[model samples]
Target: MEKIVLATSQIENIAEILEPENKNIWAWIGKAKKMGLSDYALGILPKLRIHEENEMEGLWLSAEEPEYIAEILEMENNSISLGKVKILELCSHAVETLPKLKFHGEYVMERLGLEALFSEHTAEIPKIENNSIWIGKMKRLELHFYAIEILPKFRIHRENVMEELVLNADSPEHITKILEAKDKSIWIGRVRKVSPIEHAKRIKGKLDFTLITPDDQEENGGD
Candidate 1:
């Protein structure tokens, strides 16, 4: 069998190739790590992904070929939010191994460092901008299917905040795609009131959310 290596740009092309299917195949993605070709490069590619939504744990297998396996991964987007664990991971030495291209590595380190500081001093923890409360779905992506990478999101709150931003974060009955669909139950933070793009855009949407500042901390775990 031939080995296949993927790059960030190539993964974008690959991302479009996978769609949800009933074959019991899936690919779980974790950004900030194991994204794009990071899995292939970092020697951490899963031999198979678990179809948790399918009532199976560690039951799905990757394709025999590497390229084919990547295709299989593109199909499933089931994610788990190890909320607090992610926090610890970010603040620890694991971050030292992050990719350095485009300052991506530096950005995460800075974010985690800031989070470490916030967790120690803040009255309450806020979910950061890039972080999520939705940990994906327990079922397949059927009625709930949407994408947000193209949208120009406006930060209701400012960055580098010294004040605590309050947000009512929660997780609803929707399946996540690219995002973790983070689990907000474990979160403790705040969010600002966003302008009414439509009255419900801020308070309600496909999924519920929690509050976090441009600089805040997750508890001690994450996906």
Candidate 2:
């Protein structure tokens, strides 16, 4: 176990000693500092030490590294101080391993919720294609339309409207005229396979559109 004395002033200096030649160790040190780890402790940390290994090997640390660090620090301090040290370590690991886990988890949960709703209702929802839209049946005579439309208003193609609208299988009159007018049967087939109401609810948020066109014109008038 490589050890360094952690005093308030020596924290930054200690971190400098552990800095890698290629990568900016300062950024990681800053992050550790933000998590309330002393600079000296961060310098000698197992994870940072692994960074000194071959570049191809990559730096890896276990989930318990922070807890271990906390334990060591507690022993060194001769007293227990309560704060976010443990939480920060766990969070850092989570942040390091998979940043998109939160988003992916939410998406999976939303899909499962929709599946449950469909099972309870015993109805198949109309699928929306083209514009990333869907129409589903929540109850008898009640239909829902959900979509993720990308727009500067120009991106809204005919496929968007055709796929997002759902129609009742038994009642042809309830079907939208636009979908009925389409030439391809396969496109219509895809729109008919929509997911249930619970899934549709995930789309309750607003559609965000990014402007690709530059706001300022150049001196030569080039785009």
* Candidate 2 TM-score to native: 0.15
Q: Candidate 1, overall lDDT?
A: 0.23
User: What's each prediction's TM-score?
Assistant: 0.20, 0.15
C-alpha lDDT score of every prediction, in listed order? 0.23, 0.24
Error of 1 at 21 (Å): 26
The segments of candidate 2 whose C-alpha lies over 4 angstroms from its true place after superposition are 1-106, 109-167, 185-223
For residues 12-112, write the lDDT of model 1, one tens digit per residue.
Answer: 55443244451232243422222223322222233223222222111111121243333323332223212221111121111112111011111111111
Every candidate's CA RMSD = 17.4, 21.0
